[model samples]
Target: MVEQVSVFLENTSGRLAELTRVLGNAGINMHALMVADTSEFGVVRIICDSPSKAKAVLDEAGFGASIANVLAVEVPDRPGGLADLLETLGDEGMNVEYAYCFVRPQGSSAVDVFRVDDERASSVLQAAGFRVLGASELYSS
Candidate 1:
């Protein structure tokens, strides 16, 4: 499992930039980011080198931030890699709540970050021949 930092912000101009600036100023390097928004608010989920520090900095900067555990799995950088993974999860009765992907700096594979409903997702996926990444693996390319 990897730590993900989630920040809540108003859907206003400059809010996103301000959040990024805060993370940048704190020297937190973001590996992956996904944003979900409504008309009035937005939630920014970030995979970073220092999730705890990132949340702390965001809080000090007046942004509501929290940490969550998410599974980071290695997937082949091929057309059907994602589909296969999803299929395997479905076969095992695992439901994915949300997910995002990012390619590493020096790899032929992409990492898929998932917020799944089951706690056994990591073990199940590993049994199904997937590499579940921990914080060190996720942060260091």
Candidate 2:
């Protein structure tokens, strides 16, 4: 399990830079991130070493930041791997809300970070033979 920081920012110039600057100044290191934008606003989801500190700085900086639990699963870095995982989840009656992928140079496989409707996603994925990573595992280089 990993704690993701969801930062809600306006869809304006330099907003992403500002957010990064805040985190940088606070000594927070980002492990992975994704940003989605709408006409008026954007949501930046981030995996960081210290989510609590990140959220605190963002909140003091007047950004709407919150924490969410997401499962980081080690998956094969090949086609059909994601499909197999998704099919398994679907068969288990698990609903994946959203997901993203990243690869570490030292790792042999890619990791898929999934936000699911089930709070027991970590256990579910583990029981299904998935390599569910802890926050430390995800952050360690």
Candidate 3:
């Protein structure tokens, strides 16, 4: 299982920089990040090589953080790939709370990481022809 660290941050100056600085100071590497903001706050979802360390750093810095189990699904870097995966998840009765994608390596394609509301992830992967990658597989160097 991949554990994603979701941090609630204020949409103010230096908020994001502070968060990243804390993580960097703690020697935690953020592999990928996605930020969704409203008028007052932002939800920063990050995939780090060391999620526990990242969480500890955020806590020490007085930031509220949460960890969620997500599925790292490798998909082709073409159109309809995401739609197909979402449709499959819908058919399987799995609701996606949020999702983000990162480019795979220089030679590889892309990988979509999804945080599902339900734990029916394995079934979805098997049925959708997607490979479920573990946290180490996705984040570890």
Candidate with top TM-score is: 1
Task: For candidate 2, write residues 43-73 as lDDT tens digits.
Answer: 9999987898899999999889999988889
Task: Please give, for residues 22-115, the per-residue lDDT of candidate 3 as tens digits.
Answer: 8988888777899989999999999988787788879888999988788888887888988888888888877888888998666466888887
lDDT of 2 at 105: 82
Candidate 3, poorest ten consecutive residues by summed lDDT: 104-113
lDDT accuracy of residue 20 in candidate 1: 95
- Model 3 gets an lDDT of 0.84
Q: In candidate 1, how many Å is residue 71 off?
A: 0.5
lDDT of 1 by residue, 25-108 (tens): 988899899998999999999999878988999999899999999999999999999999999899988899899999998999
Off by over 4 Å in 3: none
Q: How does candidate 1 score on lDDT?
A: 0.91
Question: Which residue pairs in candidate 3 have backbone atoms (N, alpha carbon, C) closer than 3 angstroms, thus clashing?
Answer: none
What TM-score, over all chains together, does every model reach?
0.96, 0.92, 0.91
Query: For each candidate, C-alpha RMSD in Å?
Result: 1.4, 1.7, 1.6
